[model samples]
Target: MTSQSGLTRRLSDADEIVPDSEYVSESELRHGSDQVVRETSRSLHDNDTDAIMQMFTEKEFETSDLLEICGPFLLSDTAYNVMYMSPGIINMIPDTSGAASLPVTSLFHPDDRPILTETLSAQTHDGSIMARLKLKDCSYAWSNITIRQGNKNIHRALYISNTDELYRSYITQKKSIATLEQKAADLTRQLEAVNKELEAFSYSVSHDMRAPIRIINGYAHILETDYCADMGEECRRLFDIILTNTGQMNQMIEAVLGLSRISQKELFITDTDMPALVKAVTDEQLSAVDNSDKINIETGNIISTRCDSVLIKCVWKHLISNALKFTAQEATPHITIGSERKGDKVVYYIKDNGIGFDMQYAEKLFGIFQRLHKRTAYPGQGAGLATVKRIVMKHGGNIWAEAGTGMGATFYFSLPVTDQ
Candidate 1:
């Protein structure tokens, strides 16, 4: 009932036409048809085109003229039977002659057929969906299909645009990210194995060295006790030096064994009352030494945290003992122990007015057997701070110090806040 000119005007007035740059040439479409059958075999006659136009007129919809200017598109009934297909869409079909009877689902990729079937069965289909459509060459291209419903849902028009290039690029990037993640995991495992082997080697060497050191110390003690009175003063003094050097060596070996044990120990994490722990360490240190009256120790508010009790206790013992030993020379010795909130972590510090070393040597303070002062002056194997650093790091924390020559020192450590 609709005139040919009227249908052309209606389609030209429609707003969703594909740009001219996107339109497929008739020659290109014929090239695809040549691989199957001649283009004339699939072409519609003048009256045939008029009858398809009349079908749209009865439904009060006009869309056939759009087939010339739009991108690959198709019209289908609720039953998914192809009513009309554009030349560009015909180029995508391997056999255009059989297109009219072909089910629309056959054009979609196998993995995407279920999605198209679901949309056709929906009460209404008016939005857009993305799907992979099968091409004439048997390959698939990503497409954006915009669905437009006609009056009374007699038919639906699908405007499809190709996005194959972009989809392939995204797939390539995803595979690259997965490969990088796998490489990182492999490197982490290798590092862990190397660290375990080093820890075992150190433990074995320390364990074996203890016996020889013990023998030397025992023999030297015996010679001093039985032969000191008969020997000259210089000989006795030299013998005393041997005993002293052997004692220091034994202590260093013990420190190494202790360090290895801490590395291998399993953590027993718990909610610890930090204030009580600090108080207990301070009390025990003061009780063991007779200088409690000379030293002024102050403790401020320390928040609770979750940590391993035994390991953390060792940390407190080392830090507190170091503070006491360094501040012993001060006429008015003072020590402060407290903690404060720093963002999402709690920073605890021990301040002492002691004989601090230069700030330039701070990096060496936590290395085993590394000392800034003479052994006779400090009377330590320089393992206390190293042990403290290991314990703090095991708890997922960090330790650092600030000091100047002859000035006071402050050691701070941070622990994440696990409780409100």
Candidate 2:
């Protein structure tokens, strides 16, 4: 048989194992009465105790020492009856004095009994299992258990490691995710309700508000045509002013309704030929205006983008119309449409050699009914840029303008590039 000092040296090496010669007979293995047997048992138990104590005291250990150090561990038979337990286990568990020879399930919470039973049942002597176990205070802790088979498949050593903090964090994160999901569902319901109210309001504005405006416009037309011959020049001029103001009011109301409709419209995104769309809008606008010959339009290489074609067409129309209207006084109106790639998006811009506004008011440029130029000079209700901004926003894009007084203006808009 191997000597006690030799066995102790082998255990100290941690990586080396004591040979079978070191083990005593079955009777001595159980009772450990022989001097050599007693010393070997004491060495094994002390080695584990020292490693575990070092772990708790110094908070560090080598990997080879880890199996012995990670404790609150147990030694059991194949039937999961507790044969022996580490000192740490006795200290960690309350009322465990008579725990020896009892089923391992006694140490677990009632809810966790099945977990230990299943792990013990499925595990071979060579394999191990992990589970969360309850403590004396009723709090749960995560543990990793490792098992080592002994001679005759009779005895096993189980190494346990605490992992309570990690499990607790995982549970907290799961609850947080559940809470966020509930909040998202609540927000979705609120959004749907708001959309319904907006739809109703839009319907009322389209029908109820426009009816009176149309009637006023019709009466003004009748007064100009049917009563013009009977009225003096000053009265005719007054009638003219009434008709003009009514027309402006009608445009403003239409612009507001258009903005509302665009917001409600569902986007049908597709690969749109931006150059062709711009050309079409400019052509249509040119056809409607009398000063089309005075305007010179230039277009650069424009890449195709995924967007709502109808809404984008509206955007281009408003921009082109604004350019033409602002530059109408110029001897030669110059307008350029072009685009370039910027990171994940394509930025398209319209440059106009026309009368431009101060950059200080740029923040208010896209606001509804906000005007930098007088209505008498510009001949618009200042809703064109606002409508363009809304359309751009609907397409997951943005629009802005750069300008200086009397120099020129460039309007830039960006659209994300997506596969067709």
Candidate 3:
């Protein structure tokens, strides 16, 4: 578009940006505050007074606006003048470097000064003169120095820049991060110790008690069969009762074993074929005396899991068996086993249409030897769920039950994604 004359210019290509060297001064330049950069740059050249004024020069120096944002500033007029000074300028003045200069050097620990001097000198030589210095008061600090070329410039003329506040804040932040990391590590160690203890305790209960129980059952059977006729009727009846006690004791012992092993044994993690394990557990239950026709098993998606196959199958058996046993009087017991992916975890659920417990008893359900029903009503030592609890805990997972009295029970367990 043209101005007053109504002449028009067509737009072609977009303008490109280049560094200062390529945009060299040509004819005449402007300090045209009224004009846009593109218009001004097109006219700028060496002859322009405004352009010379804008050029940075060695004689004048000032702290950069950037430096002000990072920290506080202390400036001598000399430092102010030399800020934009060309590199390699030394600013030291022997007298302004501060009193007791030689004496201050003497105060440095004999072993420390050489290392400090070498390091400070190296920094100066390499174009960076910021240094952390230890003061006479035992407080340490950081200071930035600009060395400008001058007749009076020497180490003695130097005055240090104070940065204790910024340094202190940096140190504090570093220390806080270190403290949190250490606390996290300590907590991890404590948790690991507690878990080890729980595992050991579970193992001891399972392996140690089962043997004595088996012995008691064995001897009771031998006495009943071998000494029946030789014994009086009263004695025979007592033996028979002992035999019954042994049988119940065996059931209790096995329950305890199941619970303990579930919690204690190290898991043999493998990629399990879920359909196969479910079928195996179901077949085992069918083999149990008088159970097949009484129960109907409902199956769903049997997802594969990286888990202890044997122990997991045992968990299934105990839950299913419990469902069947509790609903022994029901015309037909219905049991459902299924799985789903919940976020990064696999959730497996077992639901049973049986003598479900009151919801208030849920917390006590997984506790060893804790039972809601009487011994004769639902005969169990209440070890099965406890075993389930341990197994879940071992996998860095959790188990819980949802139920209402006589409405049926559902147990759900979760395994972490890592196990998948």
Candidate 4:
């Protein structure tokens, strides 16, 4: 039972062991010991030192030869107390004084000490464990730790290999993922605050501004009916102008209110007969205007779709009235309403041969208060398309338009088909 340190001291003088002997050179000794050393280490793991000692004796090698070939490792008792530290281990450590007698757990990071203790206590021979070790400079490095039963029943061997660079990359990636998740949460809160502010603004505009406009229109109407005869021609003309301007203002207020309400409205979806709905809206629009006779309306066999009937009706009313108003100058106006299946959705379109607009401003058409034509040419507050867009979006659908000046216009909307 030679102590590991005594054996290590003798191995330093190994060149003198087989010197000037019969035909055996130093290279031959080393080559023959390579295979024998590998077998000894394997047998050491299996606690079979009898075979290892027999092989060494048969090869005419001493215990110092075995110590020289065993390579770098640490020997510890079952209690994890360090018994021996190889010369390689001493060279790698920046501070090697008193390292051999220290607890083997002192080599690992404080947080990793418990994990190493549990793994060794389990005496698991199935596989190796891994942990971060404390380097001599107080920095940390990752290493794979293998525990094998030693030749002595009370002793064990620990084999450690550096794996620091790969573990550091893994830690960096995990930190980046955590940072990205925090940023995403912050953005979501900002978006929620902005939405709340918008709702409050819409409510204020709808309620606070309508009262004064209503009062002005009411006064103008009273003067027109009660004081018409008492006024001169000039006064009468001025009164008529005031009344007409007030009427336009009232239309503007109604349009703003409609746009605001669409944002707060809830949708109730059902199978709606679109052809009948379109016919009813068109008939109502035609009856209101005296030029219904000049307008030729054509409707296709539209498929029934699942949608909010009230909201969809509003969409049809705005589109139909827009066609009628723009085509007032034409001696004969043509308006077509139809629907077709496209992929998983039904695309419905309203096409009109009316005073169309340039396609370049198409993107702005659905914005609030956005209009291509002047108020004089088309009497509107420019909120019709904006309202239509909101309603379409609330139903998880989309709206778009195509037009060229005097070439008529077509407005298309898509709704997903419901599963049967």
What ranking of all candidate models by lDDT puts the best one first? 2, 1, 4, 3
Query: Which structure among the candidates has the greatest TM-score?
Result: 1
Clashes of each: 0, 0, 18, 0
Summarize candidate 1's per-residue lDDT along 1-420 as a digit string, tens digits: 012222233333432222122333345435552332232222232224454456567753445444454556789887877888887677665675844487777888988989888876673858888888777667677888878888878888887765434346555766888888888888889878977887877867676777787788888888888867688889888988888888888888788878878887777899998989999999999987777899999999888899887888888898889888888889988999999999888899999999988999999999999998887777788999899899889888999999887798999998877653
What local lDDT score does residue 114 receive in model 4, on the 0 to 100 scale?
90
lDDT of each: 0.76, 0.76, 0.59, 0.75
Encode model 3's per-residue lDDT on 160-204: one tens digit a residue.
333344346656876898999999999999988987886676566
In model 1, which runs have C-alpha deviations exceeding 4 angstroms?
Answer: 1-145, 148-153, 157-170, 218-229
Error of 3 at 49 (Å): 31
Q: What alpha-carbon RMSD in Å does predicted model 3 have with respect to the real structure?
A: 18.6
Candidate 2 residues 73-165, lDDT tens each? 678888878887765566556666754357877776677788778877777657756666666555556667667777878877776554334
**Predicted structure 3: clash tally:** 18
TM-score of the candidate numbered 3? 0.51
Report the Cα RMSD per candidate: 9.9, 13.5, 18.6, 14.1
Error of 1 at 338 (Å): 1.2
Colliding pairs, model 1: none
